[model samples]
Target chain A: MNVFKLNSWSPYVAGGMVGILICLSVLITGKYFGASTTFVRSAGLIEKVFAPERVEKMDYFVKKKVRIDWQWMFVVGVFFGSLLSSRISGDYRKTALPPMWETRFGPNRARRWVIAFVGGIIAMFGARMAGG
Target chain B: MNLLFWGLVTGIFFGFLLQKGQVLRYDKQLGALRLSDFTIVKFMLSTVIVAMVGIYFLHDFGLVALKPKTTALGANIIGGLIFGAGWGLLGYCPATAVGALGEGRWDSLFGIIGMLFGAAIYAEVYPALKTNVLAWGNLGKITLPGVLGINHWIVIVVLIIAFCSLFYWFEKKGV
Candidate 1:
């Protein structure tokens, strides 16, 4: 019972809960578990701020809209919760380039960002086109 | 606003579970790629199986509509390859990237930015994709039971058994 106070839960427990959440998500929203679309919505949100015309012109944006939704808030919550814990544990140092990325991609922040950006596009694009 | 309110509550719980699952840890994600850690696999597999059973049953009972996406083999293969390449380069999937950033790693911001740009591009090209890559294989909203022409419950039970066995092995191997 006190295990609820622990930093991490057993994978089974957490995973099971996520599964139940999936069911609830479908029941409540009529959608299964989705995360990729949030990025697209964010794109619309950002673009509308900069170029409202471009967002209006894009068919996908026109259909999906740019409002904050469940998954977006879910991601935000994930972030704030982590921020709170990391702050409490005093483990919140910022790294411009993680050494792991540097050892492979080299010490260039720009290059890393480029690859990451490309990766996000590829992943989301594939997920969309492939129906994954 | 009611739906949105529930959404906020759901997000808090969802985020809490993700954090507690420890799948947000950099080393755990890296290990998953390396095939050394089964934490992500365990978590995701469990999530999938449970969702499959729950959603399917709910749909069967007419409690919800099953909005299964079409099965486009060409799009799947090509898109998956492209996605894999990007994921390999980025070092974390989209969800984990957000979670990692929240954990104060901040290194995942690049992937998030990439997602924004990628999503923007995807929106513009989506209509064309319908006729091209997305049209390939065109199996209209078919499920495993639909393909095999059997009861979904049967398939679900078999999958659960299979997953449980895999879980047992992982535990024995001390993953």
Candidate 2:
């Protein structure tokens, strides 16, 4: 009956819920669930600000044809939805670093940010290379 | 029905599930990457099984079409390696990072920002990257059934059973 812990559900149940969501998505829209596409589109949108023609002619953007699409909105919804869930369950709390992170990586905020940024760059590079 | 509406609605449910499933938890994520925790893997395997079966059923009913992404051996292996490294380092994916941000883990923001910049970098040099890396071992759209030349149902059933057995074993091992 712990309000704070109520946010945590059995992995199986949560996984099932995700499955159901995916099922509904495909059943209704003929699209699979993905989030990386939003970042790509966001990047494309930003690129248009500086080099409009380059972005316009880029084969990647040409194929994707960037605008705020369902994926971007969907990702935004995920953020808000998570906030709502956490708020309702009393699990929402501001923390600069999770305990595990501090214990493993030490309490160096700058280092954490640098590693995360570099990792993200490498990861996204791979994602696009894989056409994700 | 507009697809955007569907995306918004489903995205909410998806976020809720990710939060509840503890996939947004840093410890759980790190453990999974380190092979010390099977919880996330079980969750992901269950999701794949469900989606595989459910999507096939929907397709059979003529309610949807299955458009599996193209499989490129080079792309998958290379991308998977980098993604795995990043996951091990940041302990978050694009989806789970959003969930964690909602839960108020500010550090997750760094990873998110990095992801955005990374995406920008990829977009900037996409033409060259596409030609050199993306074209490697390119295999047109494919699926398990197509690769194995078996019925989708058969693959689904087999994978379901296999995953269930693995799940049971993992639970017993308590890793």
Candidate 3:
């Protein structure tokens, strides 16, 4: 079967593949299948360009160090892969906000951004504190 | 060979899997949180079980050292609460945010930017958290099997059975 042409794969098969990925991730690159660190390091990389002094001062950046490492490229690859899938399967839809969010949270784009931003902060902090 | 090539490949496959699994949908994410859909849970649980078996097997063979982080109750509890809050609010976790973007959902951009700042903020407070919240209930590096003083496979088997049962129940319930 041309998996790429299909609109979706059974969750079970996808899950199984993702599981093997966790193992392959370690075996090939000595890293686990995770995406949070890429966001963190990318933050540092962005800051380093604009405010080198601030980047140096930030303890997290000092520890994590800003570089396009394997994880970073992995995330980059994720973006392209999904883009490819959506493009192939014709499931891509551009939207500023989902209907559910608007219905539940209301229709203010600014409000949505604020909430999403706050959510990001909380999620990242939680992920870091919990270790990866 | 570039060290990143393998990671990129891994990520590409992972992305494809996530997309194919249809977990990238906002409604699916919201549904998972609302208990209206079991798709996300099954997918993630399967991955967890699979990884559990594979990682431990590889470790047993001495191919890789198992580096389990400390089981800090405080960090886990507080961090989990905070994480859930963000995830619920944004309807997109870090990985999903990227995938949503790839699927042409522009709103996930807010989450992407927000998380970047969140990381910065976490860095600023790391020192304080290290001595305080992060130190709470620090149990050292340990796993469930290790804590139980049993073979890892035993725990893995039990978890697999339990999860399979749960999946069966979900199917029965039409979830």
Off by over 4 Å in 2: A1-5
How would you encode candidate 3's per-residue C-alpha lDDT over B23-124 as one tens digit per residue? 887778888999999889989998988888999899889886677877889999899888888888888888888988988887888888989888888887
lDDT of each: 0.77, 0.81, 0.85
lDDT of 2 by residue, B91-141 (tens): 788888888898898788888888888888777777776767677887888
Which residue pairs in model 3 clash with each other? A119-B86
Clashing pairs in 2: none
Off by over 4 Å in 3: A105-107
Best by DockQ: 3
Model 2 lDDT tens row, A15-101: 877887888887777768888888888888888999998888888778777888788878888888788788888888987776788
Instruction: Write down the DockQ of candidate 1.
Output: 0.58
TM-score of each: 0.87, 0.94, 0.94
Q: List where candidate 1 sits over 4 angstroms from the true fold.
A: A81-114
Candidate 1 per-residue lDDT over residues B107-134, each given as its tens digit: 6887888877888888889888868877
Candidate rank order under DockQ: 3, 2, 1
Candidate 2 residue-wise lDDT at B68: 76
lDDT of 3 by residue, A1-132 (tens): 777888888887899889998888887678876788887798888778889998888777778877888888888888888888888898887878887888877778898888878888888888887776
- TM-score of each model's chain B: 0.90, 0.94, 0.94
